[model samples]
Target: MSEQAAPLRRERRTFALGLLAGVFGLLLVPTCTSCGGADESQAETRPLVLSTIGQIHDIASTLAGDDLRTEVLLGAGLDPHTHRPTRADAARLTAADLVLENGLHLEALLHATLDARRASARPVVAVGESIPAEQRLAVGGAGALADDPHLWMDPVLWAEVARAVARELSDLAPAAAPDIARRLEGVLAELAELDAYARRSIDSIPAERRLLVTAHDAFGYFGRRYGIEVASVQGISTESEASVRHVQELVNLLVEREVPAIFVESSVSVRGPRALVEGAAARGHQVVVAGELYSDSMGPPGTYRGTYVGMLDHNITLITRALGGDAPAAGLRDRL
Candidate 1:
């Protein structure tokens, strides 16, 4: 084989080896099948097993309707930039018929990790890969995530990602394509409404107060979509810490601009941001922690912001309201 062809063949070879192992051994014996529930609860109409990020898992679960059997490797509050898969995640990779990688380097470390598993005939579908070029944005500065991976920030792009995921899962289990597509369409419609509502809500906020300083640069995509000035104390990865100079600079900005409130993230460490708030206070400028926003992970199940749509809607409300704009609770579904 040629140079490029060599690795391709090896990838196929590894996958074939895994396929044989699944065929011969009892590894696929479904030990964690029920997830502590009955058989029906355990397996959906098509038990679309997934090993990827949680955002995709949440969207897939909602779209698939049934159990869907999603095992998130990089879980809530776990940063994928620094995630090193353990043996447990390896088992999930092997069992998954469809490995739904986020595609964008969001799960930068995970692509190679799951590729190593090479699930039998299972496809490691990069759902974000199918995202259209127009909707995509560039990651800030020189780095691996130079092409922004956090596309879930934009609901339109997120809808595309969700559709691709649903389609890939459908192909893996064609019997459920119709069901998956139907649920996905409903979700996209809801997302469109959410986007419109967000536009109207944030539009009311003064441009001067549109500055959003987050815990990290994860909101690049969100900021771009909403015309907000976005800055983060840390870089793209939470593993990357803020430099002394960077922290000092942000404090000075807070003091000079009198930026009232800064937002914290659910998944990232708050220690860095706490220092910023305290630093601002020492300078006689009080910066409020407006609210905790869902960044890499969504809220717990059954809440308003658990899914991708609800997550952003909740964020829009918190940011707009905190920043002197208005987004009523009833705007989404119920009274605010």
Candidate 2:
């Protein structure tokens, strides 16, 4: 088999096994009458919408408004790529009226749990997969060519995700469809502005210095959307390890291009990024770890950076400033 095809096959096999295990795991959970089915009191008060990531949770909450209750299973700094569903998570999945995940294997470990939930005739939506296949970027460069799951990095693409969430909310609560649509419109406008800001800010960077180096390839969509070149020490998924050769290659790039900053992801280990900095220093090229970027996860909950827009704003503003571009220290809404 070809080298590229080998990893792809392995990933598919792993995903299949995960799904099967999820199914059997769910079967082992002692069935509670209330757990197996939705609670009557909760449904009447507000239908629950559970999401795998905070980005989707924020979108659902915005569109649902007072009509539904929204919660995210993954919190700040949690890596969904490596996150396996606990027994408590399984129960929460079972109890939730609806489930939303980024899909496209972004939730690599949660696939089985999600599939198990879907098999039970429960409502589960992979919102990221809603994006048309052509619009999605293939995982390129020496690895299996799969769809990149970090669509939330691009505001324009994430707007489509918001629309999908709104549709789901509408179908879940037809009575509140109009209200959901209104909220979606506002969210869309805000995203459009964010997209503009990203473009303008990124464009301000000198052409040669517009390279974005990070711990992983999560920023592919962001680079494609804003015309910046992205290079990383790891592949699309955080599950993959950064090889010594890969780190040396990136360090070479940093030294060659004289790139100013490399970033660490909040959800990923700093070891890989730190390695890059150290590698560059050994070659007599100084590079700084600019700041932590929200990759697989967003900021802490109950803060502006915790929200989807805020997450992108933080990334865009941080990247721009670190690369010698101009941006407000407080970010687009002065909330950085």
Candidate 3:
């Protein structure tokens, strides 16, 4: 291998499951593949590791189970658009049988890296290709935001992504197709239940209170699915900045419309939303911090909101209660 493709070095396994299953390393990426040295049980071919960002990796792991060796390329809280691939990352890619990405222009940075190695790789799966155009939120505005890449925000849409992931993994590792299919069915059913739960939860809130204001424009699909009106300070891509004029406009809307709450995103700064709150307070209109939602990433592991289902459930519960809606002891979330 040349300097551009030299021998790869592996990082030491530094993390163990901790309190509340919270991950201590904010930027941990599972970088190593099997060395063909572990026990025979661990030696079973594992799809060379289906690699993608956090949430997709999480959902696929739940669906694919032990059949796939999953690795998240980006860590929990990094911005995907600006995430650069490290030398270790490139090594993971070259060693893998396949790669998975959201790819509605979501992983813009990774495109260059993938393209460079595509000729020699097994496959690079862009799961979003399977989504029905009408079902997805159409793009608007300029730059990376010119296309809406946050399609995974909606559970229904994400199920489509699961199907594509399973199909690609099955293609790479035929022996696991049977298992992937079985779990894919269960995964789709769970997603539907989640969708219904969110809809009912949002519906229970009075129509006037169904407004969702957040730090970034990652909720377009979500707002369209249920009836919430989503307003984010920044565009879909984290690289985009909210203009001063946009801030003043949002502040004006919050005060004039008297929105009960505004939300902060875990992956981004809350300064913009806080400004809106203060702007509201200055005019005698109070807006409280609703909850920290998983806009671009999931929560700390083992929390009520770590996985995809848990993430949406937490969001629904918070949005409903914060906006004066009620919640049953358990959402009528039934798995098919």
Candidate 4:
């Protein structure tokens, strides 16, 4: 047989065997279909792993490595809090082998679609929900922010979510468990490094200027983890409207603290922070609009900022610099 046709023949044999094994309720042992030895190329035919957003996609991709094909349901610059799924989204969920999400009310409108799929026995996991309850933050007073869904803001907390995703993927594809575990260990190490960088950089900020004013309350976890005081006009969810009183209060705090800059979240509109700037200026306090921060979503796909590590690095670098902290101009690894 020609070398070019060898892989095709192996794939056919494997498919036939997999069907027979399924009929007998036996697990089919996976093999490297390309060259008769262990190789990751055959993973191109692996199960489909669907994620709700880019952050989760990065986690799933990191864990799955070359063992599975992972994709994100939501694209860049999309707000998960206010996102409403379309018919195509419903179809994607229906066709998913496993659906992963942040899941602390992050995809509020998309939950029903995911639930419908789950009710039918589809493998859908909310990786972020796996975090310990005590570690989770509560939003506003009672109405909103009851459970903060922005866990990715904290590298340590997100490491736990990555582990949960690894377990879920491994359970679904037992043959690839060993590979998944190995990659997960590496991912955890990177996350730990990112966490350490965040701590050291944020700690260097001048104590009095450690105020993080943003468009929304997506940074509560970040604030709690990094020792910055977070203030936002909108509550946890961007769907909530900001009241005049809230804006006024932020303006007052800005003037009182003489905060130099206010940031706008990438996934949210710039109007909130602009209002704060105007309000602060009206009170004779000039608060410049700082750089944008990745909150509910990651950066554009295919960019460094789009990856999980890049997203956090960008945030830490921006926060440190804007708040008068010491950090490299290019961020953690000169990749900013």
Candidate-wise lDDT, in order: 0.77, 0.92, 0.77, 0.88
User: Lowest-lDDT window of 10 residues in candidate 3?
Assistant: 7-16
Arranged by TM-score, best first:
2, 4, 3, 1
lDDT of 3: 0.77
Instruction: Quote the lDDT for 295 in model 2.
Output: 88
Residue by residue across 1-336, what tens digits does model 2's lDDT show? 789999999999999999999998887775655565666654576789999999999899989988999989999988998888899999999999999999999888888888898899999999998899999999866665799999999989999999999999899999999999999999999999999999999999989899999888999999999999999888898878988998999999889988999899898888998999999999999999999999889999999999999999999999999999999999999999
Runs in model 1 with CA error above 4 Å? Answer: 1-45, 67-69, 119-121, 140-145, 329-331
| Residue 291's lDDT in candidate 2 | 98
The local lDDT score (0 to 100) that residue 155 gets in candidate 4 is: 87
* Candidate 3 residue spans exceeding 4 A from truth: 1-44, 142-145, 302-304, 328-336
Report the candidate with higher lDDT, 2 versus 4: 2
What lDDT, from 0 to 1, does candidate 1 have?
0.77
Q: For model 4, how does the per-residue alpha-carbon lDDT over 24-90 read when each residue is reduced to its tens digit?
A: 6533233324355445555356799999999999989888877888889998899998899999999
Of 1 and 2, the candidate ranking higher by TM-score: 2
lDDT of 1 by residue, 1-336 (tens): 579999999999999999999876665455545444576664455464674777788777777676355656666667777778777877777767667877667777776666675534556877877877666776656564356678888887788787887777787667777888888888888879978887888788887878888898888877877888888888887778898889888888878877788999988888878888999999999999998988877777556676666788788888888888877855466522
Per-residue accuracy of model 3 over 99-213 as CA lDDT, tens digit each? 7888888888778778876776557877777886666676665563354778778898888888888887788668878988998899999899889888888899888777889
The total of clashing pairs for model 1 equals 4
Summing lDDT over every window of 10 consecutive residues in candidate 1, give the lowest-scoring window. 27-36
